[model samples]
Target chain A: MRSINAADITEAVANLFKQANYNLGADVLAALKKARKTEESPAGRDALDAILENTRIPAKENIPLCQDCGTAVVFLEVGQAVLIVKGDVSKAVNDGVQQAYKEGYLRKSMVIHPFSTRTNTGDNTPAVIHTTIVPGNKVKITVLPKGGGAENMAKLGMLLPVAGRQGVIDFVVKAVEQAWSNPCPPVIVGVGIGGTAEKAMEMAKHALIRKVGQPSPDKENAALEKDILHKVNNLGIGPMGYGGRITAFAVHVETFPAHITALPVAVNLQCHSARHRETVI
Target chain B: MIKGIILPLTEKDIKSLKTGDNVLLSGTLYVARDAAHRKMIDALDRGEPLPFDIKGQTIYYMGPSPAPPGKVIGAAGPTTSVRMDAYTPKLLAKGLKGMIGKGVRSPEVKDAVKKYKAVYFAAVGGAGALISKTIIKSKVVAYPDLGPEAVLRLEVKDFPATVINDIFGGDLYIEGKKKYSLAQ
Candidate 1:
């Protein structure tokens, strides 16, 4: 078995959090530039300009892209052939996040209790970690700094298998319509199809890390993305939902086989920042 | 046209505003988000004084990151406003004259804007870096245990925003959508 030091994971995750906070993804920046050119509303155009300029701040001066440094979400793709050494992988990851948020001046958004005391965890620890075992010996880590505002608007539904293409299309469109500016448009829509309820929700969120403008690998799924994109943008939710022609910058769909009777659907809304970064070790 | 506005907006100032008005706001401002709003309401219930007076004042929904040394505040921008909808009407009734944030408001909150002759402004969401440049100074006014969610009294100059809701019930989101909507 290939042994990997958990310290490497910790250090990598720490740096990822620091970078992802202020560094707007290049793909997201490109999409916004294109949107700014084609956006119909004058107000929407101005909003787009402000957004584009905000992305430049980190390069000139070190400041987060937005104040809500978001909940640290880490996805681990671990190879079955590997063994973690020196420490636990999960603890390493949390330790990395804690150091990064504290030192990098990122906001510590995690609360100790959901309902009661609601105390700050201070270090933004206990990252929402999703782990999967794959074939290779390498560990791939992806950090998505997911803002609470957009996350709160994510929706999941378990349809009776009868709620086919049209059902999904209607549901996603309505979710975007209802979420409106709250997710901070022009938003990116991530659709998870054909998985169990929780898996679908996870897939939907995972879809956001995909590069903008790239369609799903499946021909049929790509078409679904296009259809959803068209409908969502046509909702006139525009940039920052101030109303324009570009409510959604892109729609990505990830699909997996589900039980015969289940047509689980989940829509994950990502705000304009769409901050995420990945590294394989 | 981009209009310059001074803070502590009164009913007269709000009545003069309309939805979609581009404003460059200057003067004193307070920042609070979900946790701070909840705490403020709890303080109200306990009959304790608010950190700052509510009359003719404006609140911005945000919890900024820690400043990166030598700055008055860190990247600061509007958070989703509707999260504070529950506490907004109560605050408005007590003379909270204006609010600055992003996102759609609940119907009740919008109604409160009209009833109280208050105005709701939308700062550019995701433009925290640019927005923070406008903040001249900031300090924790209350609930320090809340950390970033604590109530912060901020002094700002020429902060850019758009009037999204006005005293006359003008709603920019609805109107903008209706105007550009393909189906319409």
Candidate 2:
């Protein structure tokens, strides 16, 4: 069995958080550039240009791209054959989050409670972490800084089995249309179908980790993504709601089998910043 | 397009602005999001003085990511404005004149804007990195315990943003969508 120190994981994840916040991923940058070229409205075109320019300036100067440095969401793929030495994995993750937020000067946006006594945690700790046991000895950690705008726009619906494919498509398109300029388009649409309510939401968020505009390996899912993209862009919400051809940069779909009588769908919309970083150790 | 102008802006300056106009902002603006808004509103409800003077000041709804080494701020883009609607009327009453953020405001906030003659502006939401260039300096002005949600005083220059809602009830989001809405 391969042994990995918890300290190493903590440090790596900390760096990932800082790096993700500092740099706009290449895929996201490319999409913004593409949007700038095809955007019809002069205002929309200009919005895209500013977005692209923001990416360049931040990277060169090592600054944040937006003020809503989102909640720290960590995804862990732990190898069953590997042992985490010297400390609790979860605490390590939180420690990493604390250090990164403090040292990096990132905004601490997370509050201790959702509804009651909404108090700031100060160091952005106790990250929302999800772990999966995988086949390899290597551990992979992904940190996605999820902002409130797009996260608030997320939705889930449990449908009857009869709802099927058409229902799924309608639901996703409607969600995006309802979101309009709220999620800060152009957005990356993540659709999770067939799982239970919470599971569906998880799947939708995980789906966003895929590179923007890349097709799913599943042909049926890929086709659904394309159709949803076409319909959402047709809504004409455009860039910053200024009107243009590119409202959504990509649509991603992930699915799992559900109960015999249930068909569930969840939509997770992410704004163009799409701040995420990953490391394998 | 209104050319770049520096901040510590006066009511006279932002008052002259209209919906759909492009402006490059300079000077100092305060950063406050939900947490800070709540505190400010609570203080007002208790008839206590505010942490900072609101007259002629612009508040940005953003909680930026952490900056890397040798940087003043991290990807600092605007957050949705609607979330702060509840507390806005109170702030408006205190002589606030302008706001910088993305997304729409509530009807109550809109009414406050109309009643108070304040303007709401839209900064590209996801363009954090680019916006930081305009922020030449930043310091926590209040609620330091609130961390990133703490109210911050920021000095900016040539910060790009467009007016989304003017004091006349004109909304750029509504008009822009109408101009671009595709036929069903």
Candidate 3:
């Protein structure tokens, strides 16, 4: 068995958390530049210009991209043959989160006793972690910092099995329309389909890690992404809701096998400042 | 060219603005987001005086990042306005003239804007880094314990924003969507 030190994982997670918030993914940046040129509305073009410029300032200044640094969401893929030595994996990840948020000047957004006490956790810790065991021996860690404004706009719909394709499209479009400018337009739409409710939601969020404007590899899923992209843009929520032609940067769909009776779906939107980072060990 | 906006927006300015106009707002304003808004509303319930005078003042709904060395403020951008919906009508009734943030407002907020003759402006939400350059000065005025959510007095120069809601009952969100949406 390959033994990997947990401290190294913690250090990598700490660095990744700070880095993800400080920089925009190259794919997201490239798409924003293209949107500026292609956006039909002069108003939309103006918004894109600001967003593109926003992408640059943080790198130069060494500042977090947005004020809302977001909750640390870590996805772990551990190889079955590998052993994590020296410490517990989950605890190490949380430690990394605390170190990064504290040292990097990222915001402490989590509240303790979620409903009643509502006290700040002081350090953004207890990262939302999801792990899976894979066939290989390497461990893969990805950090996706989800901002509240966009996250609050997330939705899940358990449609009737009979509802099928059109129902999925309509629900996704309706969610985007209802969300309007709330999630920050020129947003990325992530759609998860054909799983249990929670599983659908999880898949939908994971779908966001796909490169911006890239279609799903699966043929049917790709077509769905394309159709939803067309419909959502037609909503004309535009850039920042000021009435421009380009509303969403992309629509991404991810699916899982589901019970024969169920057709569950979830929609998660990310703002134009799409930030993510990944590392493999 | 960026149109200039003078702060402590007046009724005349409120009436003159329209949806979709991009203006570079300059002058003094205050900042507050969810936590501060909540506290202010609670203070109101207790019949307590507000932390600052409300009449004719524009409030920017934002909670900026921690400033790095040699910087006055960090990536400061607008937060969602809808979260502040519950406390807004009370502030509006007290003569809050303008608001700067991103995204849609509730019908209740729209009605309050119309009823109170106030205006809602939107700064590009994710463009915090670009937006911070305009913030020339910042200082906390109240609710220090709320950290970034504390009420701040800020002076900005050539700060970019668009009027999303105007006193004339124009909502850029509805009108904009309808204009480009194919189904309409």
**Which is the winner by TM-score between candidate 1 and candidate 2?**
1
**Cα lDDT tens digits for candidate 3, A149-178:** 899999999999899999999999999988
Tell me the DockQ of each model, to 2 decimals. Answer: 0.77, 0.62, 0.74
B1-184 per-residue lDDT for model 1 (tens digits): 8888888785667888999999999999998898889988999999998878988899999999899888888889999998899999999999998899999999999999999889999999989999999999999988899998999999999999999999888999999988777761
The number of residue pairs in model 2 that clash at the backbone is: 21
Where model 3 places Cα greater than 4 Å from the true spot, the runs are none
List the candidates ranked by TM-score, beginning with the highest.
1, 3, 2
- Can you tell me the CAPRI class of model 1? medium
Q: Which residue pairs in model 3 clash with each other?
A: none
Model 1 chain A worst lDDT window (10 residues): A54-63
Identify the candidate with maximal TM-score: 1
Misplaced by over 4 Å in model 2 are B4-16, B64-75
Native interface contact recovery, model 1: 0.76
Q: What does candidate 2's lDDT look like per residue over A1-281, in tens digits?
A: 99999999889989998888778788988888888888888888988888777777654565666667788999999999999999999999999999888877677887788899778887877799999999989999999989889999999999888988899889998998888788989999999998799999999999989999999999999999998998888887889876677889999999999999899999999988888999899
Clashes of 1: 1
Each candidate: fraction of true contacts kept? Answer: 0.76, 0.76, 0.78
lDDT of 1 by residue, A1-281 (tens): 99999999999999999999879878998999999999989999999999998898864677899988899999999999999999999999999999888888888889999999989998997899999999999999999999988999999888888888999999999999989888999988999988788999999999999998799999999999999898888899889878899999899999999998899999999999989999999
Q: Candidates ranked by DockQ, best first?
A: 1, 3, 2
Which has the higher DockQ value, candidate number 2 or candidate number 3? 3
